[model samples]
Every structure is written in structure tokens, then in C-alpha cells.
Target: MAEVHTVYVPRDTTACSLGAEAIAQQLGRHLAMHSPDCRLVRNGSRGAFWLEPLLEVETEQGRLAYGPVTPEQLPDLLAAGLLAGTTEHPLYLGPVDDIPWLRRQQRLTFARAGVTDPLSIEDYRTHGGFVGLKKALSMTPQALVDEVKASGLRGRGGAAFPAGIKWQTVLDAPADNPGNPQSGRKFIVCNADEGDSGTFADRLVMEADPYMLIEGMIIAGLAVGADYGFIYLRSEYPLAHQVLQEAITRAEQAGWLGADMQGSGRDFQLEVRLGAGAYICGEETSLLDSLEGKRGMVRAKPPLPALKGAFGQPTVVNNVLTLAAVPWIIDQGGQAYANHGQGRSLGTMPFQLAGNIERGGLVELAFGPTLRELVEDFGGGTRSGRPMQAIQVGGPLGAYLPAAQWDTSLDYEAFAEAGAVLGHGGVVVFDDTVDMAQQARFAMEFCMVESCGKCTPCRIGSVRGVEVIDRIIADDNRAAQLDLLAELCDTMEFGSLCAMGGMTPNPVRSAVEHFPDAFGVTPESSAGAA
Candidate 1:
């Protein structure tokens, strides 16, 4: 009998979308007939999307990889000694870790992604999964909050607000549970409603390593004295929803969740609620409203979510990446995590590269790298193989950075200084064929379509913005239209209710300022508009 070997097939959304299921089925049937003893394991993607449906075979040396695999190629792969982990195959990518693309990433939060069977608790534990939660259980709540503060972790949901500060706010705010005065109810809401364009890290995290998020939320519950938690997930992520549900159930069964957390005498409960595809629900307040079965709309702040959130109780609302980073912070010590990046932007970010880029995938690196490095080095330039035009660093609402600004560091403050943002670490590249005018129009058009319609600026200003851009493009009173557009942007920026209206001008202004030619703004016309 031949020795049994383990074969890994990624079950991540990206992998499955690219036919990993078919590849897995093909491999399974082939293995049953030729090598019945071989074990097939479904794992999560390693964030190397260019190699989706990536297959790995465990050998005495290490896990050797073959990728972009298809069902049609299975017979040849098998014949080439794929079960024997042969390197002679053209698709063989050597040791998985040694692959330069995977090797260079600073994968802290995603340490276990793609490496373990996502549903297996034992696999998660074996690879140092619950170490942070265990360590967090031993510390005082304040101590844990202090550790997070020391780490300088910020909200990855675009605001870049310090996570530690928010945690401390929730920790200090008195829970407003009148019925249970002695043990008040505080809530931890994980904002998994990732609606930003060119962003999928949140979904990847949830589907690939559900337990990491679950463990992070549990630690947050402990840190802030929150007894209940809810993950407000977007409706598009059905796979993530299924995976999270299963992971939560397994967590409850394993004593990591439910009435008594690992017998520590602390109580924490968690549940997942689906969002109805409202882009505004990505906003924390709107998310809370949607979670409460109300129409998703932004709430005025001053009664911050920390003071009064879901159901009029103090709630700690954090983005998926923000919370998912907690367990690592607690286990490694805050300063250890802080030591990775420069300035106020501490630690690594899982930067998602998309849009007209070759080798597009997730690159987790420290915050100081320039956008050029990320786009050129890791992304391998534009997919069109043409001269690059614009680079949108943050999201749809983020600035359309011209080549001059591409050298700016990826830090939050640095990007702000350069009139750009590091919102959610989503870098979308565009080739020279892109029309900046159309792209700018799409920004307003998107705001118009996705706006919650609670505020006039976001709702009406966006509509006016689309009209003004069209007039300018048609060369109808170009200078005056440009001026009108600028003023409207100002009104939306200052008078609007939330970032939904305020940040809409970022892309519009950036396109006009950087690519004035595209907007039909000549030197004389620009001077007149100014």
C-alpha cells in the first residue's frame, strides 16, 4: 500500500469562483481510484488570488503548491505524479511558503488563512489559533484595553480612528441596561458589511478563518465587558454567512463561546445578522439601524455609538479587520505588533489590489510602502500592459491619485496630507485608457444610487453633481460648470450629514485637480473656474 498523503484544495470564495470545486471533485474521484488512502482537505485561500484553485500536497519536505488548476488539467497533473508531490509538473510552484509572493507578505492577522481547515477547531488550535484568547482571559479588562492602545491599532474601515481609543471609550462608558443594573448589557458589533468597491478583505477573513474573527470578538467582549455580540454581514457574502454560522456553532460546542467562556465565569454570546445590500449600512450607525430591523440610515453623532448604540445601549462597533486584529495584538503584546510599521500607522495592513492589474491579490505589508511599490512590485503593473493612468488607493470615495502622488506612503496621515486616503487598504489601478471624466462622474452617480437618502447633500447634491459633470463634459459653459461643481462639492463636503456626502468630493476634486485635461479644463478655463 502507498503511503497516505494530504491534499489541500482552497474553499475560499475566490478559489471556488474559479472552479476549485470542480478541481476538488476531479481530484477526489482520481484519488479514490488510484490512491484511495490519500486525504483531501478543504482549506481557505492564502490571499494569492492569481493562483486560485491553488492545490497543495503535503510531503516530508513541506507543502508543495500547484495553482490556477482546472478539472481538465487534473488527469495530466495526476499522471505527472501530483499525488507524489512531484516538482516535474509545469504548474508546480515549489514549497508554498517559499513562493516569493507568499513569502514577502507580513501575514499577522491572516497567519492561519489558507493553511488550516477553516471548520476544524483542532486545526485552528494546533496552528496557534486561541493563544491570544487564552492570554486575554488571564488579563484584566483594563489591562487588555491598555495592551490594544499600546499596539496603536486603528480602525481599518476607512476612518483610521484609533481602535484602542474606541475600545477605551466603550470600556469606560456605562452600559445602559436598566433591567439588569448589576450586570449591565453592553454589545459588541462587528461591522462586516463591506460595501466598498475594490475591497474584499473582510469577506476573505470571514470565509477563510472564521474562528479568528470569533476569537477576536470574544476578546473584545471581555475587554469592554460586553456580554453580547452581533456580526452585521452584507447579503452578498452567502459563503461567509454559512461559514460564520458553522464556526459560531462549533465555537459554542467547544466552550469558546456561550454561557461560560472556557469556564472563566464570564458570559458572551454571538450571532450573525444579514444586511440588505445597502451600501450605507457599511457605516457603523447605519449598520446598527439595519441590524435593529430599521431602514439603514446614518444617525447624528454626539451620542457616540460608544455611549449609546444598538438598542440604546453602549456598543463597541468595529470593522471586521479591526476586530480580527485584536487576538494577535493581545497574544504578541501590543508593542510587538506596533513595532512593524512607522509613525502613527502601526502594524501590517492586508492591502487588496484589484482593477486592471496583473497578479491582483492581497498584499499584507507594513504601512510605509509607497503606492507605486504596491502597484508595480506586487501587483505587477496594469493588466492592460499599457501606461498606468490613475490609482484609487482607498475606495470609490477615495481620491483618484495621479502619478505625481503615487509616491506617497500608504500611512493614513501621509495619505491625508497628499489629498488621498488609505481607506480599507483597497488599491484599484487603472490604465491610460480610462476616462477620468467618466470615472469622476461615476463617483457622484454611485453616491446618488447608494445614498440612504436621509440627507439632502448626499441624495440631492449627488444628483446635481451628475448633472454638472455632464454639462462640463458636453462643453456647456465649461468654466462656470466647473465652478458650480466645486461649490456643490463644498456644500456636500461641509453641509452633509456624514462621510457619505462629505467624501464624495474626494474623487471628483482629485480628478479635476490631477487630470484637468480629462475634465476638459484648459489653463485659461482652470484659472476662470478658480
Candidate 2:
């Protein structure tokens, strides 16, 4: 009998796109012919995208890694003793953690992301999963809410609302259980419809370490006295949807997500519902509307989701990151998690290094890394090998910071002061060749396309914005056009119904402010100041 060996391969979407599935299948065949005793395991991505189809072998020393493996190299890799970690392959990445990209990350919410089998409840548990949920089961709902509150956690889904405060409303609000009117049903909803450009944190959690999210939601359900929870995932994430469903089923079978959980006497049910892929559904109100099978539109908010969300019941709406952070806060005391970062931005954030960056992937870190450090040091500059020009922090709707503003820190208040936002912790870089005017115009065009049309400022102002930016780019009535653009942005910012238009002005204004030449304005004339 051949000795048994364990092989690890990624099931992450990016890895799959780069042929991870094919590589896994081929690995099975290769081992069957060459070394049949090897058993393969499909795990989540290491967030080192450039090294996709990364293969790992569980040796006595540790899990040795190899990367970007292709079908043609399988036999050579095998012949070179790849599984035994003796191969001198150029793609070898040594031990996974030894990689600088993986080492630098603070990785709290994403600690188990690349290490665990996404659908394996057993794998999840063996790797420090459900400890939070276990702890929450013993604590009173108020105590659980207080723990999260003390953790200094704010919503990671752009709003930055205190999650404990949001959950408190659900804890205090009257549950509107139409099915059992007297019993009072509340809800926990995970806003997994992550539509932000350059942001994949939610998707990574859903597809890679889904149990972390499930555990977080379970804690949330327990804390709010909610009997039901839903993960509103976007249709674009077929892999995430599939894996999450599998994980949910497994959790239910193991008695982690059934009607009665962990013998806690509380009843809860978890489900994954697909969204229509509309960007507006990212907003909690629109997400609630979509969850109800209504058109994905933002509802007016005085009632707040905490008071009247999800079928008129008090609801706790949290994004993937916010929910995923709960288990960490529970396992490590809230204060332990709180002590890592600066100011109100306590704890780690999964910063997605995207766009023109050379070493693009996820970089989870404590708050306070300057934009320059992220783009220049961690990212290793641009993939084009050109001088990095602009850095777009947050998502598409975020402001584009110029070189002058590179020293800006990662704290939410710092970004707010700099006229930008750390929306969803996405960082997109641009080389010197990027045209700021066209990019600025795209901000308006994106708003016009994605606007829910709930108000005049967003629906009409976005259309007018495009026209003005075009004139600015063409130098046609450039002076008046600049003035009109500024005024139009202010209207959209102040009057828009939701962030679709309200925040679109951020990128547009930032680009116009920093790069006047792109809009055909001479910097010395003060006309660009508009």
C-alpha cells in the first residue's frame, strides 16, 4: 500500500478562473498514475491571486506551496518530487505564510479564509470556528450585544454604523412575526450583494470561509432574538452562492443552524437568497426590498432597518465583513480585537489591492497604513511598471487621491476629513497614463446607469453631469461647464435619495480638483478651483 499524502488546492473563484478546477482534476489523475495514495482537498484562495492554482502539500514540517501550476507542468512537478517539497520549480512559493503578501496581513475576519475547506463544517471547527457562536449561546442577548458594542466595531459595508447599536434596535424592537403574531419574529440579514468595483472582501468570505459568516450570523441571530437569517447574495456569485448553500446545509445537519441551535433553546433558520445583481441592492433598504421579492429600490429611512426591516420586522442588517468580524471579536475578547487599530477604526480590515497594482490581492491590516504604503510598498507599484499616479481608495464612488494626498491614513474619520471614504476597504491604483477627465466622467455615467431613479437630483443630475464633463473635456464653454459641474455635483450630493448619486460626486470632485489639465483647464487660472 502506498503511503497517504494530503494535497491542497484552491476552490477560490479567481483560482478557478485560472483553471484551479482543471488543475485539481488533473492532480487526481496524476496521483492515480504516479502516486495514488495522495488525497486532494479543495480549499479557499490564499488571496495571492498572481499565484493562482497554488498547490500545497501537508508535510511533517508544514504545508509547502507551489503556484500558478498549469496542466503541462503536472508530470514534471510530480517527477521533481513536488509533493515531497523537494522540487526546484520556479513557481514554488515556499511555506504559504512565509510569503510576504500573506505575512503582512493582520487577517482577523479572514484568518481561516485560505486555510479551510469552504463547505466543510468539520474543517471549519477544527480551525477555530463556531467558538464565538458557542460563547454567545451562554451569554444573555444584551450581554452579547454589549460585547460587540465594546469591540468598537462599525459596519464594514461602507455605512460605518455601529453594528451593536443596529443590533440593539432589533433586540429592543417588537418582532413582527405574521406567521406567529404572538411569538414575534425578528430577522438577521447579511448584505452579501457586494457590487462595489475593486471590492471582493464579501465574495471572499462567502466563497472561501463561508462558515465564518455563518457563525457570525448565528451570533447575531442569538443576540437579537431573531429566529431567521438570510444571506442576500448577488446572482453574479454563482460559486459563492453554491458553496454557501452547501455550508448552510452542512451546518444544519451538524445541529449548528437548525431550528434549535447548540441546545441554546433559541430557534433559527439560515438561507441564501440570490439578488438581481442591481448595484442599488447593496444599500440595506434596497436589499430589504429585494429580499421581499420587490423591485430593488431604496425606501425612505426614518424607520431604519433596525426598527422596520425585512417584512416589517425589526431586522439586523450587516454586510459580509461586519458579520464575519463577530466570531473574531467573540473568540478574542472585544477589547483584544479593539486594541489592534487606531482611533475609532479598531480591528483589522481586509483591504483589497486591485486595479493596476503589481501584486494585487487582499491585504488585511490594522488601520493607519498611508495610501502611499499600500500602493507603493505592499502593491510593489503598478503592473505596467510605470510610476503610480492616482490611488482610488474605497470603491468606484470613492474619491481618487493624487500623489499629494498619498500620506492619508486608513481611518474612516481621516478619509472623511480628506473628502474621501474608506468604502468597503477597496483600493484601486492607476498609472500616470490614466485620464482623470474621462475617469471623472465615468463617475457620473456610472451613477446615471445605476441610479434607482427615486429622486430628481440623482436621475436627472447624473445625465446633466455627463454633458458637463464632456464639455469640460472638450474645452467647449469650459469655464461655465466647470461651474455648472460643481453646482450639479452639490445638488446630487445634498439632494439625492441614496448614495448612488449622493456619493458619485466624490470621485468626480476629487479628479477635477487634483488634475485640472485633464479637464482642459490651466492650473494657474483658478478656473479649475471650481
Candidate 3:
């Protein structure tokens, strides 16, 4: 007869790292002993990572939030009558979305994340979960692809290729025949191997609202005429993998995925294939190779994946964010989704603000915000309150940007024009204490460690690159070493098999170009100084 109030806590990896699991246990013990009428629900993070272990209590007013909680604070919170949803603690953050940090931006793909119980199918539908998939069920396959095309949604997994274009290719390709199993069968794969530094969007999606991804993949399968799909998740994210496995089992039982999807009589079989720890596996072709029990190496592209992929079948490979975005595009017409962001870069970007920053976390906004706004305003500047020196847009392969270039727009084309690429929307800030020369050297070192060694340029050149940078750092003929470094980067950029070696030069070159002072001389004075 008594009302059972619900409490929400995040099981997100970032939140867990901040002792959310321990905090959750303490809350459970405290609420049971003190407030027996309350229930705790472990949800995903709300993306404001700085305020992790955020607790949201259901109230007539709304879900009131209190945050960055630890196990030690649970007793005090209970003593303060926190379960009544009227706690006046200093750490309380009124309402979750009303928090200026979350309210300012757009969140399309991540609509249900941190809000719904990850594995609860009923919870998912209650919060606008299956609307996209239900919409997709009515339209013809070509019509669905066209709707996606009209949305102008590019790949969120670094390449920025149009998702509809890839789907159209697979749709046009032949379907699986009895005699030719590989040629006729089409495949849909979600590239969940989020190995990029400072990037946790993929992990967040999988861990928090996995059914959204399942729905997206099923929609993609229906559009591309594919019955089989797999989410190639990396091994590092144990929590994501476990959550995805449980979520898939739930969907299979609930008829969201399997031989008969939602009684539509259509088939979309989904599986989760774990990836080895090789960063190179994040590449689409390399991912396919790894999925097939082969050594994870880049495949030649004459016969494209659209025509021949995944055991020599026509396949559609999309990033988790790219596919997860589909449900929203379908539910809210493509034009509506298109109306949000700036220019050709349409829709919201879940920008991961990370590394040595003050208020770092995931901030999803439309594509117009400049780097300065992201680093300073949303991020609250550097944690150390030091002069912000440089920032890396995108992942490890992305270029390092100096303070002079902070005004650059976060648009993909704008970044490309400036010798940069928004590779998966990771922005890592570094203060004045950083040594550009050393950072540049680490770029090459990272490439060497992650390279599949499929090409001579990546394998051999990376070694030579480290040697040349050591020479530059030692001031042993710095002028010649600089020239050698430039030449080596050019070789790797043009000669490498994949982006692994090709884009490694992005950070190295940008560091050398922007902060010449770190290298001990300007280009104009290099020879004289040497």
C-alpha cells in the first residue's frame, strides 16, 4: 500500500572508476536500513562525467539530482533525509537536464541513455525507444535508405562517410542464395571497437542504453536487406561487453531481434563478437579481418566492403554512433534531424572533452560550437587553471591544435581545411607545461605500437620516426633531423595501408608547425640555430 520511490545511479565505466559501484552498495544498505520505501535503479551516466555517481530521486517536482557522490558520503546523505528528494546538500544539482551543462546542447541518439533501465525492454518503449524501429517496419527498404540519405547523417566512426550510401550499396548487392552463401548474403556490422583515446561515446551507448543500438542495427539490417549482424566490441570494455550480452539475450527473448522481429515476420540476427586489444582493429577492413578469425590486418579495397565484405558477402559496416543515430532519424523525419547542426555537418555531436581539463565529460551539441567555446566555456578551462596551450581534436590520429587555432569551427570540412579532421569527436586539452616535441614523438611511438605492420611505411618508418625525433630532442643536428622527420611523415602519410600510419602524421606535423619553439628554433632560424 505504501509508495516505493525510485532512485537512479549510473553504472558507467567513468562513474564506476569514481567509485560508483561502492557508492551504489552503500546507498542500497543505507536506504534499506533507513528508508525501506525507496528502490535503487542502476542506470547509465548522464554524460556530465565530472559529476559522476550522480543520484536522481523521483519526486512530484521531477527527478532531483545530487552528484559526484562517494561511499563515505552515503551515511551523511541518508542522515540529511536525501531519499525524500528534497535534500539541500551542496553537491545537489537540482534537476538533471536543467543543469546548464546538459541543457545547452542537443542529444538525439542518446535520448534514452542514462534515463531508462539498460536491459528493460518495457522501460525502453516507455521512453520513446521502439518508435524508430516501428517506423522503419512500415517503409520499403529503399525508402528507409532514402530517408537516411535525406537526413545527411555521416558516419560518426571517423571516416564521415554517408550511412545511407553504404546501405544503398548493400541493398543493391545480391542477396544470399542457397549455392553461393557468401555472395548473396548481406551483413550489417556495428563497429563498437572504440579504441581512440578520450573517446567513450561507444562504451556509454553499449553500457547505458544497449537496446537503442539493437534497434538501430535491426533497422539498418532491414534497410540493407541483411538478416545477420554483429557488434564487434573491443575486449577492454568488460562492462560494455557484459551489458551488451545481457541486453541481446533480453531482446532475443522479447522478439526485438531473432527469426521473427516484432511479429513483422522479418529476420535480423544480432551477435556480439569480442575484439582483441589491437587498436588497428578499429579500422573497418581490419575489423572484418579480426571478426573472421584472421590476423587483424587491413584488406585491399579494390573490391569494396559494400560489394564484398565479411566472409566475401556484401556488407554494411557502420560505427555504433552512426547506427544508433538511425532510430532518431526515422522517428523524427530526416529533415527534422537535418535542421539542428551547422552546414554539411548536421545533427548533434557527442563531443568528449577530456585530458587535464577542468570540467571534462561528454557534451552533445549541434556542429556550430567553436573549439574555444568547447575548451573554455563548456570545459571550464584547464583543471590546473593554467594557460591552455594546445588541444587535440578527434582521437590519437587527429592533429594537435594550438591556441592560435582555437577559433576554428568544429565542422569536419573546416577541420580538414586546417589540416585537421574531427575523427570521432574527442577533444583533449593540454596546458602550457606540455612539451610539443615529446608529444610529437609519442604520436609516432603510438603508431608503431598499434600498427598492423601490413605496410613497410608504418612498420619500418615508425621506428625511423622515433630515432629522428630522438635526434631532434637531443639537438644533434636539429635542422637535418627536422627535415628527416618531415620526409618520414610524408612517406607514412602517402604509403601506409590504412589511417593507422596515414594519420599519425596529423599530430606530429601539427605540433612541429604550431609550436616551433618547443623544437628549440623557428623554421626561419632552424639552420642558424643548428
Best by lDDT: 1
Error of 3 at 377 (Å): 1.5
Considering lDDT, which of the candidate structures 1 and 3 is the better prediction for this target? 1
Candidate order, TM-score descending: 1, 3, 2
Candidate 3 TM-score over all chains jointly = 0.97
For 1-530, candidate 2 gives per-residue lDDT tens digits of 12439888899889899888888888888788878778888989978886777888887767888887886777688777787775487877788878888888888888888898888888888989998888888989999998899899999999899888988888999775667553477889999989989999899998899989998998999899887899999999999989999888988898998877877677789989999869999988999999999998889988888878888888899999999999989888889889988999988888999999898888899998888888777889999999888999888789999999989898999999999999999999999999999999999999889888888999999999999999877778788888889999999999987888899999999998998878877856555455
Reference-based TM-score of each model: 0.97, 0.97, 0.97
What lDDT score belongs to each candidate, Candidate 1 first? 0.91, 0.87, 0.88
Location of the lowest summed lDDT over 10 successive residues in candidate 3: 521-530
lDDT of 1 by residue, 412-433 (tens): 8899999888999899999999
Answer with 2 or 3, whichever has the higher lDDT. 3
Off by over 4 Å in 1: 1-4, 177-183, 528-530
- Per-residue lDDT of model 3, residues 1-530, tens digit only: 22329998899899899989998888888778877778899988878888887888887777888888887887787666677765578878897768888887688877777888888899999989889999898899999999999999999999999888988998998765556656567899899999999899999899989999999999998898888998999999999999999999999998888987888999989899999899999999999999999999999786888888898888999999998999999999889889988888988888999998988888888888899998888999988899899999889999999887889998888898888999899999999999999999999999889999999999988989989888988989988888888888999999998999999989999998888899877667765331
Q: Relative to the unseen true structure, what is the C-alpha lDDT of residue 443 in candidate 2, on a scale of 0 to 100?
A: 90
Return the lDDT, model 1, position 66: 95
Runs of candidate 3 exceeding 4 Å displacement: 1-4, 176-183, 522-524, 527-530
Q: Model 1: how far is 140 from its true place, Å?
A: 1.0
